[model samples]
Target: MSEAERVPVEVAVGVLVERDAAGREGRFLLTSRPPDKVYAGYWEYPGGKVEAGETVEQALARELREELGIEIGPAHPWQTLVMDYPHARVRLNFCKVFDWTGDFQMLEGQQMAWADLPVQVKPVLPGTIPVLQWFAAERGHSGPTHLD
Candidate 1:
């Protein structure tokens, strides 16, 4: 086995969701990758790596605050998936965040969109595809989840 395969980068992902008064999950947040970063322009959930001594939730909060300029509320633990990319193997920890304070801001010079099934965004990130499927299953949605 190759040496690089042994260590996976741990990332904390925030699936920020909005719920209606009836409490049904509504629109979720998607952010375009920064132009200077990998997979630039591809849309994905917002979050970043879990630094040393930081928990997934901590990382999620920090990343969201730094990247979006919002203070997130309780983050419900969701799914965890490990994806193999050519550049690095990443363990993505996805958390569903339903409440937050402050207005949205693209602090990283990225675009943010709120969308539901048949997600209107184009060029979804590879790691984000499974998340779409997860959402589909939970929402009982059929058909394509997003554009290629």
Candidate 2:
């Protein structure tokens, strides 16, 4: 099927950002793709696809719990992007998550990191680059967002 006719997979992505006492956004979370998945070792926000009957918020909450072992609070809808990758086309629905309870477990055998602008992680996933750029824009950050 042609690109126009192909339906993009709807994914719910959680941008888990830390906030200070004054409510200023700070470092967000990133997770390395599990070893067996496509683009493995590339860092990206924590999330997964929206299931057949789930809304973006439901999917985000469920995915984060399963992937990171944390029960998220409200997932404030942030941004959406359509990305066409070699493996699949996806519509990423990013939500700014500020409140959550529980320690992260990295349930899928992936590594997780809390990162800020000019992210210290390497080999970021292509699907994740735009989210970093969005964070940079919102924070008035200038420079390469992450290492290749």
Best by lDDT: 1
Question: Model 2, poorest ten-residue lDDT window?
Answer: 1-10
Residue-wise lDDT of candidate 1 within 6-112, one digit each (tens)?
Answer: 68899999999999999999999999999999899999999999999999999999999999999999889899998888778899999999999999999999999
Alpha-carbon lDDT of model 1:
0.93
The residue-level lDDT of candidate 1 at 116 comes to: 91
What is the overall TM-score of model 2 with all chains considered together? Answer: 0.97
**Candidate 2 residue-wise lDDT, 6-39, digit = tens:** 7999999999999999999998999999999999
Worst 10 residues of 1 by lDDT: 1-10
Candidate lDDT (C-alpha), each: 0.93, 0.93
At residue 8, candidate 2 shows an lDDT of: 97
